[model samples]
Target: MVKAAFKVRHITQRYLRPPGALKEKDFIGRCIRCNQCAEICPNNCIKFFGSENGADSMGTPYITPREKACILCMKCGDVCPTGAIKPIKRELEPIVQYVEMGKARVDEQLCLSYQGKSCGVCYRACPLADTAIKVGYMEQPTVLDACVGCGLCERSCIQIPQAIKVIPNHLLASQLKATHLKERRSGDNDVQIIKFK
Candidate 1:
């Protein structure tokens, strides 16, 4: 498992797996490289990794939000024969609670709203709307912790460099693990060790 994790850590691109995807190592191990998830996608958002992403990642389904964003139809999970992508119900509450594809982050410097242009495209595109993201003065997007990172906001952003982007969950998980380890080493014995099963 540790060796698998080391390999997973090397695929450094900020790409998201399908909704309800397992942890990186487990996903790679469990996924049979079948393209069923992509076939059933109503939005046609799912794409497969080529040789560039590595052999372990070859044919693995991923979504590039900038090009096309998932509609959260939950069909990908339903078609996954392997549990790499666990089946999630096509319900709002279940989707919010279970999906951890990533979290949306806004780049204020590149945002039109921050520049007083009153762009609310991202806010209007969000499926979760006010729950996952809130718009304040000038409709500047404020990402909440509840954001499941479905990538619609990033896709809808009209900025040249994209004012909003989804930071993949694997990257976030790695950062969290590093922080916990650092805290543990710095005599913070109170820090709990989170096991990624």
Candidate 2:
């Protein structure tokens, strides 16, 4: 049971939806797997899962940021037949406001800048620059809330194992939902539970 649970978790974390993706359940249901999203992607970062990611995920478009991060052209969303990937504008504000693929996290131990070497590659790669990521002394990168999780920073990182990574929004959403459920079960009568999904 433990091994099966771990495998499920591992499979869940293996991929991320395109920008402006709907919630996981809704996306899986709404997406027709028409391959339109992958077809319109200029960066060629989008790929489909086979039986490896399970039946629900089969043919669903996903992005592997380490291989190629999204350029935020917003083309994939524009081409999607269903609302699974909502059409977001190519402008900075709309993209920032609507797109939520994942959030980038920096591992200080593996980061060169954090280890006393000056490296600002991630910061340079960020489309939002100072708004999404900031660099301090020795070019140590700091991720900010405005980050749309475009994954450019992670892709640009110089570390062998990648000092920075994007935690997919689907995973974060699931965690948030779990926490909400746990809180509701705690028997707090006045605590208003907000629906995330």
Candidate 3:
């Protein structure tokens, strides 16, 4: 049972939460596990973590973009009783500013466009195409700062191992913490050594 549980945890790591979700820690605390977000999602992309995920995260809604990417309908947040998913106005500016579920990254080596194959499906699939992703030289896709991590690119990629993927914000948050620690340690090591002359 423990081994099976571990496998589920490993698999769920790549899942993305709905847009406007709070930081992982805060979201877990505030979420009521009511499944309201999942129920209200027009695209039916939201799903609950099951027993295999264990009690820590069981029942909390998450999305597996490989299965069904979010359509950015902005409905899930509006129906959430708890503020785990903060509601944002259904407008491009608000969605761009507040709905950061993750950031899309492209693996150039695996992208057809990078190999001169002329594939730009991922770029075309993006809801925020011009803003979030742009076709660069040779048609290679370039992720932009405006990306809301909707996973549309991932869903549309034709590569065997998806060339573009959404790196969830929870994972990004951990990476930020690790980077901060490294910076702090280096700063402490550089503390000026004053020797009384």
Candidate 4:
């Protein structure tokens, strides 16, 4: 059972939630599966997981940036009857601070800019622009702390395998915890423990 659970976690594709969504555990409990977030999304980026995704995820709103990246309009949160998705203002500061959909990671080897092709599409597509996705040396995208993981960069990426991807916070937290435990058990000195709570 433990091995099966670990295998599922390892294989599951991390999905970005709507802006202002609570942590996975809390969101699952609070969400009423009303589909309000999906209906209110102006960009129509929010979609519910089907039965094949499993009972826990079925009917929960998730965004696949490859299909449609969030524009960060905050309308989904505004229409949420429950606080599963917290209501946030449509301002820059609040959105940056409160909206943590995921974090974007870049694969330097596959990036066009890193290949000397000078691609800046990801930087240009980012709504936060200079703050979230900045163009660094050789026009390479530098994801900054201001990134709210709206996945505009991933959506705009022209790379075949996608040079950039957003790692959902829930999955990231669990992975980090697992790594920390593994490192602790091995007594690895280089391990940087990060507590999720």
Q: Best candidate, lDDT-wise?
A: 1
Model 4 lDDT on a 0 to 1 scale: 0.83
- The 10-residue segment of model 4 with minimum total lDDT is 2-11
lDDT per residue for candidate 2 within 33-85, as digits (tens), equals 89988888888999987856656667888888999988888888878888899
lDDT by residue for model 4 (113-166), tens: 988999999988999998787787789887888889898889989997899888
lDDT of 1 by residue, 1-197 (tens): 54553364433688888999998889989999889999999999999988656667778999999999988999989999998999999887888999999998888789999999999999999999988899998898899888888999999999989989898898777767787778967978666543221
User: What stretches of model 4 exceed 4 Å from their correct place?
Assistant: 1-11, 189-197
**Clash statistics: count for each candidate:** 0, 0, 0, 0
lDDT accuracy of residue 100 in candidate 3: 81
- Residue 104 C-alpha lDDT in model 3: 86
Q: How far is candidate 4 from the true structure (C-alpha RMSD, Å)?
A: 3.9
Give the worst 10-residue stretch by lDDT in candidate 1.
2-11
1-197: candidate 3 lDDT, tens digit per residue: 66555443523378788999998768878998998888888888898888645566778888888778999998988898888999998888999999988888888779899998899998889999888888976788888888898898898888878988888887766656666777688976554331111
TM-score, one value per model? 0.86, 0.83, 0.83, 0.88
CA displacement after TM-score superposition, residue 166 of candidate 2 (Å): 0.4
Ranked by lDDT, the better of candidates 2 and 3 is: 2
lDDT-based ranking: 1, 4, 2, 3
- Give each model's whole-structure lDDT: 0.86, 0.82, 0.81, 0.83
Error of 1 at 10 (Å): 4.9
